[model samples]
Target: MFLLIRISQQLINGLSIGSIYALIAIGYSLIYSILMFSNFAHSSFLLMGAYTGFYILILLSSSFPLSLLIAMLGSGILAVLIEKIAYKPIRDRGNPTLYFIIASMGISIFFENFIICTIGPRFRSYPRIMQTTFVELGKLNISVMDIYAAVVAIAFLLMLSYLIEKTKVGIAIRAASFDLEVVGLMGVNTNMLISIVFLIAGILAGLAGEFLGVKYTVYPQLGYITNKAYIAAVFGGLGNLKGAVLGSILLGLLEALITGFLSSAMRDIFVFCLLILVLLIKPSGLMGIQKQDKV
Candidate 1:
């Protein structure tokens, strides 16, 4: 009975945590799709969103959902501006891809340091979260907040998928992802596409941040979780949206199982090992498409 209880707890814990990772991972995947570069600074936006949400929720007398909306918009606008000021110049120079990656790291460092300087180095707890203990089945237990996180994450992804699949903007996005020049020739505003993509990424990061704020506390270094999201995205498939989602779920389940049998301290290490092994065996990821290079 004790073992079963432990397993249940682990599974619940993993799903809840994994849902947050998946939320951020989807942002990582989408930005990669539009920008053709992996952004390190996007991670820092998670920190920004969480901190801002905390202030909005606790200090400003706003509700949780309202706080999330405002925070997401804030982050999204920041992302668009960052793309215009930082990435646009880099893209214009036709420099090597390595340069952009380095710049991304630089941006990440800037945001992180800025947060540290501005907010100090303490964790801030949520002001007014609705906490509940929910029990299900004869021998299972769960939290309402966990269910809320999972549902919100899943719904947002679906909405994104729909936008990408069923809208003109999405088509433009898809075209730009494949070849910006071609899309440009087709009269698509590449600049607009890039801005929108960054905006979308920012919004998703906010979702992750809100959950993290509730699950733990607001910290200036919340970008640390972005690393996990990036890993999950890569593990699933870098540019594949569906792949990133599945990868998050897979990592979540794996972490839960490991934590069940082993120690929580070893959970991340175990998952990283699994990621490495999976990459070694199948680099394309579970649902990623491989592009063919002509000889």
Candidate 2:
């Protein structure tokens, strides 16, 4: 009974954390599908999201839901600005992917340094808006915040899925993911689609950041931890949204099990090892479809 309870507890913890990873990974996959490059600056968006939520809660009110909404909108606008200022010009000039990479890195570094200089390097905790209550099921206890995060994440993901699957804009996004040029040739405005993608990605990043802040604490370097989300993105397949979600949940569960049964110090080593093994075995990822060059 004790062992079962422990396992259940770990599972709950894993799902809670995994939901955040999944959110971030979805954003990563979305951008990677269209841009064909990793946005290292994504962490900066998460940082902004966390700070936005923090200030909204502090200055405006302690309403968790309201703070989350504002954070998402604020981050979405910020992402649009980033795309316009940093990526749009290079993209319009038809620069190489390396340029995009360098620009992304520069943005990431600038935001990290900027936060450190302006916001200070100290960690800040969210006000206790939500009660740290627990729900009991049989012999297992689950945290209220964990349940809230997981449920909200799941709901948002479902909405995103619906948008992608059922909407006209979603169809354009899907087609663009396969081939942006082809999609544009088919009379689709690629720029508008890209903006929509960034907006969605930014919103997800904001939610993930706020949830992470609630679970842990907000700090300037907190976004650095999204390296785990990047790994999750790779594990799921760089361009596959569903795969990102699945991979994140699996990775989260794996981490939870390791932390529960072994030393926390070994968790990261195991994670990287798993990533290496996955790459070696399937470079295209579990659900990733590989394309071939035409002869």
Candidate 3:
């Protein structure tokens, strides 16, 4: 009974965290599908989302939902800005990979420090409006926040899936996903689509940031936490949204179980060990079957 309870709790935690990672993975995959490897600044955008909400709440005294909307929109705008200024020119150049990756790292570093400068070097919680409630379920303890986070993330996932599968924009993203150059040649206004994809990616990261900030706490260096999700993204396949989400959920569950069974300190190491093992066995990731091409 104890083990079962432990597993249930861990599973819930994992799903929650994994879903957040999946959000980031979506950001990575969307850009990857379009521009191929233009997603390194994603984590920084998440930080920006949290900070965006932090200040919007302080400045306007807004409610949680409203604050979140502002944050997501703010971050989405920033995502577009980053693409235009930081990534647009460097894309597809001879040294695009090296230059862009470094630029992304620079963005990440700048945000990490910028958060420190703006919010100070301590952990901060969102406004009380974002606080979650707890509920009891037949000896199984559940929190309203957990349910809310899971539901919102899942809903976003569904919306994203629908967007990719149903609408005209979905058709474009799908087409671009398969063969961006050809789609562009077919007169799809590929640049506009790419910009929209970055904006969408930003919104997703902003939502994930809100999830992290409200459920946990907002810190200046919060993007560091999403590193595990980065690993999951790579493990699942860089350009594969389904793979990234699946891997994130799996890793989230695994980490939660480790934390429950052992100690928190061991959870990170344990997860990486498992990840390495997975890579060793599966190589291209459990779902990285798309296969990178060689020049």
Best by lDDT: 2
Residue-by-residue lDDT tens digits, candidate 1, 1-295 = 9788877787887778788888888888888876667888887678768877888987888888899898888788888888888888988988877777898899999888887787788878887475655757667777777888888888998899999999999888887778778898888888888899989999989778877888778877778888887888999999888888888878888888887798889988898888888888888777777767548
Candidate 3 has which clashing residue pairs, if any? Answer: none
Q: How far is 256's C-alpha from truth in model 1 (Å)?
A: 1.5
lDDT (Cα atoms) of all candidates against the true structure: 0.83, 0.90, 0.82
Provide the TM-score for each candidate, comma-separated: 0.94, 0.97, 0.93
Return whichever of 2 and 3 wins on lDDT.
2
Candidate 3: stretches off by over 4 Å: 92-94, 130-132, 292-295
lDDT tens digits by residue: candidate 3, 3-120: 7887887787778788888888878877877676746688888987888888888889888888789889988999899888888788646455678778888888887887788668
Q: Which stretches of candidate 2 lie over 4 Å from their true place?
A: none
The TM-score measured for candidate 2 stands at: 0.97
Query: Model 1 compared with the native: what TM-score?
Result: 0.94
Q: Which residue window of length 10 is worst by lDDT in model 2?
A: 285-294
User: lDDT per residue, candidate 2, 185-278, as tens digits?
Assistant: 9899999999999999999999988988877889988888678998999998998999999989999999999999997999999989998999
> Which candidate gets the maximum TM-score versus the true structure?
2
